[model samples]
Target chain A: MNFAFTEDQMAFRDAVRTLLEKECPPEVVRARWEGKPTEVWASLSDMGVVGMTAPEDAGGLGMDELDLVLVLEECGRAALPEPIVEHAAVVIPALREGGGKTAQRWLPMLAAGEAVATAGLGEAPLVPDADRAALLLDDHDGCLHAVEMSACELTPLDSIDRGRPLFAAAWYAEKDTKVEADFELAFDRAALGASAQLLGLADRMISMTVEHSKEREQFGRAIGSFQAVQHRLADALLRLEFARPVVYRAAYAVARPGECAPADRSLRVSMAKAYAGDAATDAARAALQIHGAIGYSWEFDLHLFMKRAWSLAAAYGDGSFHRRRVGDWLQQREDSDA
Target chain B: MDLTYSAPEAAFRAEARAWLDANVGPFRDASSNTADGFAKLREWDRLLFDARLSAVSWPEEYGGRGASLWEWLIFEEEYWAAAAPQRNSQNGIFLLAPTLFEFGTNEQRGRILPKMASGEEVWAQGWSEPNAGSDLAGLRSRAERVVEDGRGGWRLFGQKTWCSRGAFCDRLFGLFRSDPTAERHRGLTYLMVDLRAEGVEVRPVQVLDGEEGFAEVFFDGAFVPDQDVIGEPNDGWAVAMATASSERGLTLRSPGRFLATADRLVELWRARGDRSDPAVADSVVRAWMDAQAYQLFTQQAVSVLMAGEDKKMGAEASLNKVWWSELDLSIHEAALGLLGDEAQLDSDWLRGFEFALAGPIYAGTNEIQRNVIAQRLLGLPRG
Candidate 1:
């Protein structure tokens, strides 16, 4: 069984990485804290990344989850303040599945970057980028709905990750808002996207820690030379490496849904989300430990990735919830085997 | 990337499963740790070799199917699913054979491989000495050149401990000090020594299970011919690294065994039903996830290798070693906790926990692997 990405996927990933490095540098991320313009989002949208996963018939690029995950990873690496993941991974899929005048109306808006959308489908109590979103896709009572942000009551909530603004909102949907697809699968897609982001963040955190460890001298030598510091970073690397393939597998399952059973796909997504959350936490902790006081400070670039890691670790079904999901499915599998 | 096997691979798997279903006995006998049991395992290996299943991925000339890495993984899955006996020749087939293919001369391969594949000569690794465990270069084992019967050879004299299956193994391979004045790693020479040779001794070292799972081999003047030398005489470190790579990589612990153990743990947890605690369930879930992760990582490695790309695992191998060993321990510990007071009694969980405890300590202890990851992989300066 081959697990190598296609050359085109690799090229696309590189292009997205180049784009993010140029448009969403650390300073650009820092500008979001001061309420910067949404120019970066516009640029990303101009590059057609916002609607990468929407159906071509729905005025989008019609890319699959695998392709979208690449862009989401870049967004996480840059700690991008925009809701590209929500737009491409969560909102687009929900709207496409909703497939009515509601989807037809906003799909073009989202595809053209004229409107931004965020989904409150995760277990998180708050919705991210809710103030800037034109549409809000909410999951309630096992039903998914695409509704306008203005129609919902919003209460701004401060998150540890200041880059992505969060708000606690109560959504009200009319008769035509409900989507006719498996909302569970839609949630898996969202969680899988979050997992991809976490993987990317962990990867970036490790790179930063490694660089810091090599440069930061203590007692006449770089701290990385110390076995204790090295071991902590190495442990972080292990977690990130293992978590990465799980995230990709989840993305693969989502992109090619017919290849796996629904329950199996759900279980895989849970594994990915659970493992990525834990790995990213390990990475953030190690980064902080390696960078010492600087990592914990607001002035350092490390906090940008660390806070997002802390935020995403609890987003879209925390580690324990996803682990429970996995346990239940395993129990079911055991019962079937017996 | 595809996870599904190709048509030929699927057919090969079906063939393997059919043969195993017909030939395999009950779950591997626990008694297989004994000398008699090992003999039975050797017979089983012969049976597999006759069917060209012993070395599924080995070249055809060496009595194998010459299958791809993917096919080999599939074969392992099917083989383990059938609860087949352990491969008595694994140390030879998996570790040494790969090195032989990489570094051995044509003559060496011709003489050594056929017997190894057929289990006519079971091999043990003699890398660890009493003085050299984690730091293998500290080994004082020496092999001095000699002219025996007008032929160039070396006389081995030293001790090698922690050789798994050494008590009954017919041959062993390891590094020796070829140049006394040379530095730690430079003077080493990789040699294939016969355990049955004169002045050789094998003393069993009983493990916690009260079985002679390993042994300490002492050489008084064990003779190894010049042809037995692998790679150059003084540049054996590179050769040893290749074997060590196999030892730490996919060869030493294939995903099939871990997957099987995870399955067993799940079954045990499920049998409790209402008695299944949430904590235990969570641990089981993590174990299952780790096993799947290991499987997927291995698939990715195989896929990359198949694409003709050499992704040096290096420290990543250490990461894998630590991950699987800990995962194994956690799974067993969870099962034992589920068993509660009954864990005091003899059970698979107890045996598994005992075995898994050695996993981190062996194959260059998990601590050493972490050091490698930190220093070699993370670019951490050596302390």
Candidate 2:
């Protein structure tokens, strides 16, 4: 009956927030965007942010996806440039499912933050952080294979979200490759993780824009005081607020899949991805509109969150793709019922 | 966090479902806008009161089980899912009763709540004037003190337009100017007047659907005893704001109504056989998602209330009103979009579309809600 986070969950979230506040400030995020050798990954690894979702037998914290969702939101708020979500939420879960001699060899290293990984589970053509990842988890014939970066050829590409380096990786089966159990579930988890990130990014954009509106004056009054500006900001807040619970519910749906129908699970994930995608875009657009010209510039930190919003929104299944999936799922449910 | 009900809540839901299953029946007239339909709805309300299902969250003394907020939400879900008759006394139970509980004297609650819960006295809100639609502070209704035998009460005079359920309502609750020298929003008094009193008039106003769901109430010196005053004589603004919060918040628009609406829309979409069109499917899915969002958001708000966090309710109420109203509007629009011109022939969707049109406009328009969010929640400067 209760939807509020438990005391333990709140404390864990606060811990992640504190770590990101100290480790991934604007300068650090900028450095990561500039292709600098940043310590953000190692710092997060030290905080167990990289392996919180891995199983206990895999030498990780053995946390749930809800916990991972909490941490990912902080990563989004900080606009942290590391592949923590890829490493923890996607790769580790996929590797755990594809358990074997291959998982045993890499699971400890990946779970212990000894290496970083990127997942190519999305329908998007590009894989994020492929250039920086030591390991690549790619899809082949609807099954996942884990391979070393050296086993793949990556053609680098530019993304609007510079913090995430994108590449089209032609992946080949390597020594540690294995078929994963629950491949579809793994993909749903990835999209849901991205949804959580977008929720965080959207919320961050809202606060930053609100703060900007209060500080920025136009025609002898704060621009935020204007009804037009206020309404747009209100719309942004509305979308984000509504999108958030769906994202959390998606996380819950993923965490307890056995308790839910498969169609319901996928539908919930799609709902999260689609809603967060649209909401984050709206928040970013509203932030830009509220900031006027300064938000368009690279000098303001607002662009960092906005670009990340655009990148993450399209990275996982985009809104149109997920919405269609939802429609199809519900239609199937109706047919079965009939 | 767990979204499933606890054991007691589940039991309560089952009890309500069972009672409703046994006692509730479909409307013979299927329209609550007409006089006969209104009487039928009032009878149903009385039936629900007798079953102790009218206001589950209120105290036992006030004809309720004194259940928790979660239980009330559960009861609402079952109530709506069963397609039970609408609450005819909602104006009294949800809108006015919260204010009464918060500000009324013990005597006022003891006298007023039992009748309200039992549907013996149906109430209507009298907030808007001809000149005071969105800006309620500009209302010119006045209530002057009249003394007799060393005891004094107020004589109310002015017009209150857009009074929901005014035609059949037995009582009126509204704010009036108590001091001529005071400015807007100041020196106002919240009064409860008997609609049957002398010098009072109730004229029905036809809504867009050609239904007499609303009316304009005129008071040519309608008498309201001192006992009917909600709060201090000149501090009605704050009292009215309390009621306004209830009107805009969870009390008025429970998640159950939207859930039922969404479920119906899904059924309609399925029956329409347009799933092959990707655009159609996308619209249906979006509607379902919006309903889920609202349900979860309301649960979150209820959780906050259970935790005794009252400060966030006001802004959250405003956000909630905007969210549900827009969601309801879009769901109806999607239904019509699916049917196209056939929407004119289907009475269900047609009536739904008509009623939903008032969502954003009433309980303060969505525009005013945004202003509240921007200034109060976002801390944006007031324009």
Candidate 3:
């Protein structure tokens, strides 16, 4: 019943955090809004985290979702402007599961950070970073197909989160390679990765507000001294603390699918995604309200993370989407048993 | 990161399950839905105490199985699943027992714990007063030093209100300003007093649920022997703080009870909920998932407590307090929403909602908890 992470996992997460601090600070995130290159993508690939989920057979780290979830959190904490989640969490794993020639072609490049990719999985529209991707994977009725960038007609969509540039892609279906492995698990991985990132964003938002409250003074004292500001941030912290472990448990369940109870692994994944989304969004709202006009401005770094929370809150599966499914899951399971 | 229990833990769970299955049905049927079921409830407590299942985490010397935190958590899960009964001795067993173990003299342990374990003495807290609900340090309850015929003791004076179950409790424990000259949070002493004593009056008060679960306890020169004093005479604040975490943290409201409520809500949804009503379905699922989140959080928290030199929960407990109390309310709210018009009726869900209303208000209020989290946990200024 021990739920503590191994020291190695802890150290690895710390190292990624250190690297994100150095390479993908808020300025770098700001630079993304100015058409600057996401050099952090190269830094992350050099750190071998971009392909952390690719199998050992593909010269990758062969890491578990448990191992990669923390790294994704670091990416989210940085608000790193890249497709690390879609590339590593979804596309590479989907390719590896395909176990075909397409997997052989993309595995080495993606694992070594020589190339980047993006996906539209679980029937979610708007392939992120599709314009720059060398390869694309799209989900159709729970089946994954590897698509080519050159063949797809791309239409760009502006995001409130500038780091994430989305595009509507129409690819040539006949030419794309269809992966024959399990895509349901790939969807869970996608949700897990996004959820872990949302957690990181949530933590960052509360911390920024907490630090701001300590320094920003009004009414003859630190604003944090007032119960109004303190209580709002405290409420944010409560949501994050409770949401975090559920995400970690989802990571654990994803890494060891057989160990999942009730043998319905998707429910855990959805729980993490839904809870993280709500927590992060709640934090974003609190961050904005607590920071007053400062957090509302484009100049403030708080908006960057807050916008990321708002965007990701609806991405993958929003609270409404996942909640309804889990609701149906609960009712259907009972019907089956009865 | 392993979530599966070991053989011994599983065996403990199985033993607990078997015992609950064998006893709980008769216990519930005999005790529930009666005019006055206090004796039946005490009988159930005795039944549990006799099996050493009343406080599984307590030491074997104190009538427990001496279970680990994991085993205890499993026991709680099983207990809530099958034996879900209101604990008559909860205040003593959950809230005070931890503090008692921390600061009690060996004699205190020998004298007090056995009675608490055996349900011979039900305990209630005497912290809040008419003047000091959230501002507990503002309490003016006094316990003056006394000596008569070569015997030393303390004479309690002043009032303590909102004493949960004080209407029926056999004993009460709280803090008193032993030194009148000392200001707030100083010169205080923690003491245990017998409710049956001559100088104490327990006036039953009707709570929001209209039950006599609360009492206004007035102390008028109630004599408590020196043996009843916990910790140093004027250092009661520190001692009480050590156990306040127990009241606000995982000890008092474990994930087991919420998870049980969540499962019941799902059942209610199956019986009455509509998928077309996405909002209500969403509420049910979110409540269930929140319960899972709480359970996972407890696992992480218990593991943290298992390590570290300062094993007691600090300000992080405020986070736990806020989460579970609200989660309890929400779960019951979802059930009531499923019930619709019938929610106003005298049902268990209505009763649960009323009880949960007290959660955010009691155990130092969620407002106080938030301040503690901000200042202590987040290192914000206490201006």
Candidate 4:
């Protein structure tokens, strides 16, 4: 009945927050906004944050979902452009579920910051060619196939989030390098990752809005003094807070996948995506609105978060898509009784 | 570090589950879905009270099983898993009973506790007023000092709105402005008023779910004896907050109840062959996860309270209130979204949809909860 974080969990959260504040400060985040930095991603890997969800035996941090969520929230708040979500949330879980000698090999590399990996969950119409990463996990024939990016044709698209470039890649599984019965789990993990990313983006946007509102003045008072502005900021804060637990809960479920029933887990992942996606989008939009004309200019960093939120919102599934999914789940329950 | 229950608690869970299995019927059976559903539910509550299953966390002096908080949670988990009937005396059991334990006189406890536990008396909250919804401190419900044959007490003459179950309840505990000249919140007093008093009237308000769960109660000089007062005269706010803190803080329902419903949701999804849609499955899974987090959060809160750390309940309960209400809404909204147009057509599903719609508006509103978190938990600057 105690919702307060344990001392260990709090210490872990503080450590992560401190690390992000020190190493990946706002300047580094801003730099990543202009161009992707392999070094920054590598630094996170070196710190063991990149492989937070990976097994301890695999040279990973072996942290639970809540730990990862705490880290991700800090990363989001700081607007740090690390591939922790890509590496930890997507790649590690996908590999762990894939399991075998392949996992034994890849998990260590992924955990050690030696290899950069990302998952393509068929979220978009065009597939991401794994050219930017060492490996690509794809959904093919109802099974997630892990393949080398060297064999695929990689093409970078003009994505909304310039900070994190999106590359569409085509890969052929010439031989079954590794096949797993966890397309759903991989999808959930990927969605959870997207949710984490959205949370970070939303949180940063809220902070930016709050700070800017306090400093920016109109009618001889800080714009924050205005009830309209205060209410908007409050609403954004609420959305971010609400989305936060959903992302963490989803990650927790994934960590102890058995703790949740399969359907329940699936529903949770979807709701997290839906809520986090919408929250991120809304917060970004509100942030931009609060900033007025200044936010629309490319000179400001607000666009970076706004674009990231937009991209992430569409990454796993949009609000309408998830909402419909929720509706269908409800209808199914009614039909069962009949 | 270990969140697992002790052996005794586990044993209690099994016993409770077995008892519930034999005694409780399916929750939504046709016969139990009528307007008198609360009465039917009260019967089950009385049975549980007789069996020492009701108010398990309350002290033995208050007619409870005097179980540990962990054991109480386990009892709830197993009870919900068995699809036990809803307790009609929940308002009294969850809120008033805890408040009485903390602030009530021994005489007050002796008189009220047993009847509440046995479901013989239903109690309702009389907090909100016409102008005081979220701003509860601004409540104008007046209680003037009155003389009854040289003995002094308060005579209540004001209106209260959004009083859930007030129309049906036998008694109400509420706040009133005892000192009109004093500033808002300074003059308030907590009084236990009989709903069946000579000058009292209760008018039910129909909600979106087509249920009259809430009511507006008017008092025309309704007499509340001095002995029935909770705590000091002007300290009603503290008592009210204590009651609210507990009500919002603890896990009122069994985690197993939500989990069961979530499982049924998935089963329905599969039955309709909607599992193929990754989008729908994802939303369902997300709802379930949110529910789990809520359950975990509630469990944590219960543990804290049982360990006699009631002060932490103030901020933590606000968190629980926000999270659970939003989760409830999200689960149903996800359900409605998945069902598409068909959701609007189905009565039961529609009721769930309507209930979800009201989630944010009730229990002091998610907006207010966030404000409390910002002002109280985070120490944010409030203008």
Give the TM-score comparing model 3 with the true structure, all chains together: 0.96
Please give the lDDT score at residue A251 for candidate 4. Answer: 67
TM-score on alpha carbons, each prediction: 0.97, 0.96, 0.96, 0.79
Question: Relative to the true interface, what fraction of contacts does candidate 1 keep?
Answer: 0.90
lDDT at position A255, candidate 4? 65
Error of 1 at B58 (Å): 0.3
Question: Looking at candidate 4, what is the lDDT of residue A74?
Answer: 67
lDDT of 1 by residue, B120-190 (tens): 99999999999899999999999999997899999989899999889989999999999989888899999
Candidate 3, residues B41-62, lDDT tens digits: the string is 6777788899999898989898
lDDT of 2 by residue, A103-155 (tens): 78888888888888888875555788887888987777777788888888889
The lowest-lDDT stretch of 10 consecutive residues in candidate 1 chain B is B25-34
Q: What is candidate 4's lDDT per residue for B43-109, written digit by digit as tens?
A: 7768888888878877887778788767776776676666565566777888888888889999999
Expressed as tens digits, the lDDT of each residue in A146-189 for candidate 4 is 77778777887876665566788777764566556488777777
- DockQ in order: 0.84, 0.83, 0.84, 0.16
Estimate every model's Cα lDDT from 0 to 1: 0.85, 0.85, 0.85, 0.72
TM-score, predicted candidate 4 vs. hidden true structure: 0.79
Clashing pairs in 2: none
TM-score of chain A of each: 0.96, 0.96, 0.96, 0.91
**lDDT per residue as tens, model 2, B46-165:** 888899888888999989998888888888888777777667788899989999989999999999998988878899989999999889999899999998677789988889999888
Q: B226 in model 1: Cα distance from truth in Å?
A: 1.3
